[model samples]
Target: MTKKGIVLWALLPFFLGGFAQEAYFPPAGGTWEQRNPKESGLDPDALQEAVKFAGEHEYSGPRDLRLAILKGFEREPYHEILGPVKERGGPAGMILKKGYVVASWGDTRRVDMTFSVTKSFLSTVAGLARDKGLLQSTGDRVATYLWDGTFEGEHNGKITWAHLLQQNSDWSGTLWGGHDWADRPPAEGGIDDWKYRPLREPGTVMEYNDVRVNVLAYALTHLWRQPLPTVLKRELMDPIGASTTWRWFGYDHAWTVIDGYRMQSVTGGGHSGGGIFINTEDMARFGLLFLNQGTWDGRQLLSPEWIREATTPSTPNPNYGYMWWLNGGGEREWPGVPETVYYAAGFGGNFIVVAPEEEVVMVLRWLEPSQIGEFVRKVFAALP
Candidate 1:
């Protein structure tokens, strides 16, 4: 054989090994495989230390989520419980290396409210609509498709799908008795100041507001001509082998008529109330799917291009994407972690962190929010 041919053959196994190490999918209904920490290039003792730290730092909040909601956002004017809220479980999480469980704590099967982590799932539904051609472009003005006065005003009419996905729409108006100005209002401003505040141009500023998030949910529901939950189940979750226990909900008065059938518009978070209630295992599965760049068990459930677009940082917030939080090496970046890492974060310390370069997916629930950066740094310290 030629010298070139011999060299190619010598490198073949290295390329094959890379492929083998990159993909692993747990079965739909059976037990997830657990890899020995040492075999997975991790220090088991250090990993346990991380897990212990997570357990010890459980969120110090009322288990009665309703009271927690009220007290947590007491400064916001007129913030009341408008949707379903459930008591959360103690610290429960799973750390996965190449889709295999490396460590887990608490009850991974217990279902609980995931708050704004639901926004990531909601963002996925929008991506599905884009893929299926239900909607055209993220850059398209929402007013063009939703002409029902939701986006009719001059400022709101300029709002695009990209704006809502990035939480920068500055779209005005109320939905389901939740006023746009009442959510996480400015620390210095009074009611009138916020209510009559000049609207920032869409996509220029990132403000975390549930009312505006719910507006995105409302628009996606209309575009899909059905409940967003139904779309998510049929397209993403079911295909991902997720269990039946997960649920998405909206406010009590969020019912709307679609195709002559009444359907409830789901909320994108649990701030006022009602969001995704799911288990840690399912959350891990979701993170795994994104870690694999939108493929599941060799099937492409979401487009890789869409996943790339979703994780790409928006202009306003360097640490934010299309509903996902990024480690953009800015103020929010975990000190020693990679800038490529992104996560889905929610109230009361629910997080699904995806680290692509490390080939890891971690679902951490009910850890104190302040300790997330420290917890992640510990986990990474265990790596080879």
Candidate 2:
């Protein structure tokens, strides 16, 4: 076997048995043919109940999204011009079984900001690069590729691609006008406490800092020698037959020159109002691709090995894999879902839940995050 094939087999341990049956996939050009709930082996009444429950549960946090947004950024008024920024929408979602749409609620076509879900997509690029031998190994230091000031310092040099994917890089730096410590600043710490905090050893401590994630975007962009979105489009998105309407956003202040070409380092969340702003159907297509083990139609869009690594639990946080949430071991992130189920979840309950065992790919948006377990329970109960 070739080196690529050998690597794929090594990664197959997590995806031991999946997609053991055949199923339908939507064609290109944003067209889909859905199955009736009964035809898809779903309980129609139960599915309706689940959909109803999903529509009723609103994001129970702040009444205004801007307040939450400013709080998250902790900076001056965000006037970034690069997006496709999110205009908060009402509840929207869809349920897919074996790649066929079984049921849907709200306006799945409405493009809304899927906050942290962008991290999964960003991590997907890293997976693609690794599969192509760009990074050689996840253990390879990110500094090897990004020799720029981004990874120049002693502490940052120790960070690796795996550490970034696992959110344990603990990389300290300011990018796009946001400080690493500024993100989710501790209530007890004063300014010096956050800025001068000693750098925790990379991969030892898992911290969800968007600045580091944006740094990943920046480094990946530098290595690819092209914009991350362009790479994602040519590589994963188009091959999956996703929509032409979808977009990945970066902050206005995040632009930089690479190889004499200008590029923007997109964020991993809509924290400062720019990340992934995609519609539900497109997001479902992305989910379904993973459910299909990164194979769309006959072509393998992403290496099974990368998908395996992405879904497997990180040592620091069992609940978090490479940007996707693992739902069974140390903590049950989504109760009643299969242990094999993993998901790309965003703030405000935007999620793309994939259950390989159940042959299901479900998406939900704008609901309370706390209510996802109940909602997921309903979906699983209604599954065929």
Candidate 3:
């Protein structure tokens, strides 16, 4: 049998038995017909050229150097992990390193929904606000900035900015089922119904919920006096050369409500449940920026300290940091990840991984949400 066939046969059992079954492989050229490159104003040739350039140049850093070397020798196993995703059925995937599109096996241009990964980007915005003095500190109570009467009760009043950032708000609600009591409009009754129903106090446990993050979006927009997307575009996205082809899924609609007082109320409450979409290259650029400590080609887009702290594990869970995810510390985390590697991972496998020690950044996008953890680990292993 040929070498390629042998490799496939050897990996078939592992691919089929493990989490790889859920992976969605992209076409060889990384083109997604659903979201065509031309429609998004991207040149496929240029994208390929960029990837080629990245592959040619060698990167030397503390952690990912070996992976880089393996890639340089063309001996790295890129195709193995991607094979299942391609044949079995999954989303398109892309792999980037150091601002270069090194290898892509599937539809790379498609803009898939990156579920909670939006929280990581939003956290960066919040950090910017704090760094620029727009936000005092993570310790500042949310009530200090938002209208006093907006959030009800002691728990809501006492909930600090840091609490929200860490997902320790102690708010008893889930954003997925739409059954979260905290999601109810204030006029309907107020948060008093279930705001303080937490089984534990704030900062004691980590619960992944989107309502708290939505509230954070509301708080930031209220403070900045602008929409979240506008602030991100002007301050963050444009600086990184991100195209405006992205969209936030939930905020696409506008709503108006009539209050009990018969006054028309315009609410901008849909900016939560972060789902921001962008092309593969822009996402890779984001990874590169983090790899370079929030700077790109000499411009300091984000403070170095912020990048450091944001990627560091703040809670007992080694997998979580400011808004990013760390790989080394968690029990069920990525196995081969160096202790220094951290990533901003989105739902459906949108990852902006920064291996500072390795001087590398990797971005991967996939359609199946189930492959997120496994795919990240595979990418980490594939790195030299």
CA lDDT of each candidate?
0.92, 0.83, 0.55
Query: For residue 238, what is the lDDT in candidate 3?
Result: 78
lDDT of 2: 0.83
Ranking 1 against 3 by TM-score, winner = 1
Which residue pairs show collisions in model 2? none
lDDT of 2 at 63: 42
177-258: candidate 1 lDDT, tens digit per residue: 8888888999887999989998899999999999999999999999999899999999989888999999999999999998
User: On a 0 to 100 scale, what is the lDDT of residue 99 in model 1?
Assistant: 90
Which of 1 and 3 is the better model by lDDT? 1
TM-score of each: 0.96, 0.90, 0.64
* lDDT for residue 277 in candidate 2, whole number 0-100: 84
Give the per-residue lDDT digits (tens) of candidate 3, residues 1-384. 999999999999985543223222222233322333233334555545434433333122122222322342232112111100111112344454434444564454565445456777788888889878998888888888877354556666777777777776765433223323434233444445344453566676666655566666657766676666777777777777666676644332321122222211111222232256566655666676676667655567889888777776756566777778787666647665567877776533456767765445556554333444545455444444
Candidate 3 residue spans exceeding 4 A from truth: 1-90, 172-199, 249-274, 367-384
Specify the highest-lDDT model's number: 1
